[model samples]
Target chain A: MRKGDELPPLEIPITRTLIVAGAIASRDYQDVHHDPELARQKGSPDIFMNILTTNGLVGRYITDHFGPRTVLRKVAIRLGAPNYPGDTMVLTGTIEALEDTSATVRIVGTNGIGNHVTGTVTFSMRDAE
Target chain B: MGDDPDTPPPRPDFYDPDDSAARPKPHGANDSTAPGPRDPDAVAARPQSGDTGGPAVRPLAGDTDHQTPRPHAHHPPDDLLTRLKAYEGHPAAVAGVGKDPVNLPMIRHWCEALGDANPVYTGPGAVAPPTMLQAWTMGGLTGHTGRSSAYDELLALLDESGCTSVVATDCEQEYLQPLRPGDRITFDTVIESVSDRKTTKLGTGHFVTTRTDVRVGETLVGTHRFRILKYAPAQRKKPPARPQRPRPVVNRDNAGFWEGVEQHRLLLQRCTSCATLRFPWLPGCAHCGGPDWDTVEASGEGTVHSYVVMHHPPFPAFDPPYAVVLVELAEGVRMISNVVGTPYDKVRIGMPVRLVFRTYDGDLTLPVFRAAAEEAAV
Candidate 1:
């Protein structure tokens, strides 16, 4: 149980389309993000999302919950494990501190297998009517 | 608490387009109106030409569809070849070139100071690391060691000319042979071109591209291209605040000092035998290898010995324009600290400063130094 927590568990379906899109969007041309054989050569279990992709996905998940009105003030993240295609990532956030107009949320992203990325996000919100 | 907690509100009209406060125009609505062409809001709302539209597109300002012209797409092969050949015989120039080969001992000492033990550098089997070459080249170890290399001398020249902002924007290098210890390499650099660009916060400056060629005897080893942006003074944006890190607890070997620092005191270890003060919080003094020492509180006042305004944040807890300073304190103990409370342009060698403690997350305290006087004599 955490303070200022309202959103439910967000399950982001990981797909090859999303992985490829994320890689191309970040200008990361690493084949491991798209080609399975290249990823295998690099000692990965399979084609996996890159750091930038993981960051984008996690940012997107939080923003979707808060809606377009919220602005992301800061995000600090550390990559723990890899997120491969076909693994659904569940992004969970716990409000660590709450102010009159803002809140600091500790967001942890994990797949069914294990945790992938852990980070703290500080965001500002409009007053509740 | 007389008001009802829960109440049903009146239903709003569905087709009320005249409600003045219902909706505001989209963001960037007043960006521009004298348009030869315009993108409709509906089209703009849709993600264009990339994936993960939220964070990615927001940072990039240029045309998304502007295709990067191929290396030689527009120019004829002969013309490209001619330009390449013209550059072949021309001497190579590097930006921020130094006078000596980075004082090898100094580099090793700096790495050790950071408490990093990456074997590729310190191990017996370690070859010249790729990064070491870049560092060495900047410290001016390319060729002649008698005077500051052409690039170092150029910076001095530029500084004397009153150029306020000097920034290294792009660095591209091709490594042919791995550099090894004891390899004396000679390098010559030439200014290829300098062009004016739009003014940034640092100031209105020009982009200078220098080509550097490294040679071992008559054999060509490698080439480096360096681009630096120099600007004049202007209003600078305040860097974003860094996230907090948990403080590490101090014990017997370091206890009296951690407690003092928590109380905003600058404490140093003084040797009992030689009366020498050691920095970086080591176990013993480097001068006499004396284990017996006494705790001394520093006044936290010093003069800047040398400094660098890092545009690139090296750690997660720092931002750009952060000055990494080497201060010669009154006690003669030069310690490394981040200089705050002054414009980046105002920092200079021999500038007086006083220590200030910045508490982070209510636990960790960082001893940052700030200018001591009202106005820094530029």
Candidate 2:
């Protein structure tokens, strides 16, 4: 991977199953991600994706693009808008800089509302063939 | 303006010690002025001689009875934030070591729990999920006993300031290498930073961040940054509404478990081929990969394998300072549930428990385990 190379956008359909499954998988028991009514009570329109889910998705995106050999060094993302069910989140990233064996990738995940997540991911490419 | 015309003026005898005309004498039997036994430990001696039971019901370690004890105090100490900040860069966990090697069984359990069907996580030559980074570092059922003293001191200070409740805010992780089976991991964590005083909907407290570096042998493999808010639970103007427990997500693979629960039967999935029982319900057996399975109704007998007293980020549905346990069933599968009918701290490993179906809210019934010791005593 070289600086300025943009990763292909990954489109994921947000489903209730995905929201709840992701929340459960991450060991996060927060209700806003699983219960629509609870989410509403907490000032959201519907059940939304959790930060861990977003992080997992981002990890999947980078690993898929960089191949199995690419090792994730860091994933630092801050959540913004909520990714509610029935919406599609498209994650895209561009290589921000390149070091000897690693590259800094700036990623932004957007949905119908706006940017749901934005952050930087560092990957070590030493094991790449 | 000094005194209203309708108000009676202060009596001349108001300041007199013998002023029975101005004030009634103390009359309660406990208010007697005659000196009784001056024993300092009098109150402590009042309990029955056989009350070993008192300690059995003592509050769990992390139980912060915030709302009942200090309902009127909303803000933490003014210097608490500063003192917490002084702990920045201090060791939170040291000489931390992973008890079990990064193995397939744990990775498999994680995938099953999350309903993750990632092909790479299974079969031979499989790698553990990257997100399993923290799981590998967890202290398991008994807990991580390698926590440093400074971390305990900081928590004690936070507790003293009435910022006794805490909830994990978020975590950021970076993986440098893929973890495979047999890879032993070790980690060391340091206090990263402490945020200034802030008021969240939960309450007013500081956000503490700890950074952990995970290594395999000598190679640094990952870095995990976890943040938690230690705050006083917010006081409601009116009695707070009891929140409903979030319903479990039942999918095709695990629907049988919930169905069994509805029938008041605690079912453990037993692989028909290997006869190995498993829990949290799985479609296939981890031991033999047998897709066909049957259910075994548990005898409702088990022992607490491990437990934690949840006392942070108080949730509406859950009472803080409650003990959540990992129980090893008599049939040999482990499941996570709340330990009831005993003090959170008193729920110890190896304590016997019996399953009971409880209606959490008016609507939902869950299989909860109560301490068998308490049952026998009653």
Candidate 3:
């Protein structure tokens, strides 16, 4: 990976199953991710994805590109907008900085509403080479 | 790779009036469309309204169906939040011990459930997923044996004050070491801080935060900070519709497991070369580095190795405080599943259990365990 290189974008079609399965998989029991009516009552349009799912997808995005040898050092991400079911999220990233053994990649995941996730991931790529 | 062949098409919009056949209308609501077969269970779960004519009776403070009122009606007293400050730094859960050691089986189940195919979670030098740090500290069905008295007191105080409902807002975990199988884990948690009175769409409440330090025989492995809102559930304009359980994501690597459930059979994989059995089917053997594997039908006999009662973070499909068990199959492989036929608190380690297939949705089936012992018959 080199600075300014654009990582291929991953498009995930959001579904109720994806939201709930992702929540339970991450051990998150929050109702907003699984219950549409409950989520609506809580002010959201529908069941939306949780931060953990976003984080996992980000991890998968980077690792899928760098191969299995890459070890993620730090994944610092912030939530932007809610990712609701029936919406698709497209994740794209750029290598912001490159060193001899590691690189810093900035990522942004956007959905129908707006940016769902934005963050920086620092990973060790010595073995990835 | 972008389009997973196994993914089922998305369901139609729930609120679409034309799609009345897709979802059942809420009870007592106007039905301009054809009536479909209604689930009695769903009707039973709906909160009963005392005065249907006056207004929809809001669920009790802790009800999972609790709704935040469209307009703010109440704001908690600031002094009440100040009193909560006294409990800050108080021990929440203490001497919390993990009933089982950090092992591969649980890790595999987690990975399979998450649709995570990361190679680092498996193979010869595999390590537990960093995100699974909290799972290691879970007390299982019996629950945390040594909960702090102060923590219980705080909850009682909140209940008395009518802030009885609770929901986990979020959690942050920091892994300091790579945990390997066979590592014994232990942890202690303290109420890190309590937020001032605040109002959200859910209701008025304070955010209670706790910090837990997980260690393996004195070596710090991770730090987890969990936060929740203890609030009085607000009333909704109308009764909310029942929520549905999310379908599991089955991919190529783990499609066999779900298929086994459809046939009401529990299957485990054994490496064709080394004969090492695994709860989750994998392409290659972790021990022998073999590329081939075969199936072994499980007897379904097992014991509750560990478990947890998810009390907070209430969801529509799940009732709060239900017991989810980790079963050690007679086949000698442990798997994460739920224990039925017993109260959540009655579940314990070493309790004999038997496997049973449960159907959640129209086409979803999963293997769950039920307690074998009844009336304390040892």
Q: Judged by lDDT, which candidate is best?
A: 2
Model 2 lDDT tens row, B1-378:
123322322221211123123222111112111221223233223332124221111111222233133232233332244345445556678879987899988777666544456667778888887877877777644667667766776677777777776655556788878899999999988777666656665566667888899999899988999877677665655544555779889899988888888989998889999999888787789999999998889999999999988886467677667898999999888999988788887889999999999887676879999989788888
Which candidate's DockQ is highest? 2
The CAPRI quality class of candidate 2 comes to incorrect
| Chain A alone, TM-score per model | 0.87, 0.95, 0.94
TM of chain B vs. native, candidate 3: 0.44
Output the better candidate (1/2) by TM-score.
2
Residues A19-119, candidate 1: write the lDDT tens digits.
Answer: 77655544445677788756644444467766555655555555567764454554545544456878888888777666676666666777765666666
- What ranges in model 2 sit over 4 Å off? A13-16, A27-51, A81-88, A111-116, A126-129, B1-77, B108-123, B139-143, B148-172, B199-204, B229-378
Per-prediction DockQ scores?
Answer: 0.02, 0.10, 0.09
RMSD to the hidden true structure, all candidates: 25.3, 23.3, 22.0
Question: Candidate 2, B326: how far from true, in Å?
Answer: 43
Pairs of colliding residues, candidate 3: B140-B307, B140-B308, B141-B307
Ten contiguous residues minimizing lDDT sum, candidate 3 chain B: B8-17
Q: Report the TM-score for the A-chain of model 3.
A: 0.94
Give per-model TM-scores. 0.29, 0.48, 0.49
Superposed on all Cα atoms, model 2 deviates from the true structure by an RMSD in Å of: 23.3
Candidate 3, residues B1-378: lDDT per residue as tens digits?
A: 121212321211221122123222123321212111123332333324432231232222333233333221232343244345545665677778876788888778767655668888898888887767777776544567756655676677677677766655445566678789989888988777767556554566667888888899889888877766687665555545556777788898878877888899999989999999996777889898998888888998999999999986677678767998889999899999898778899989999998888887556788998777652464
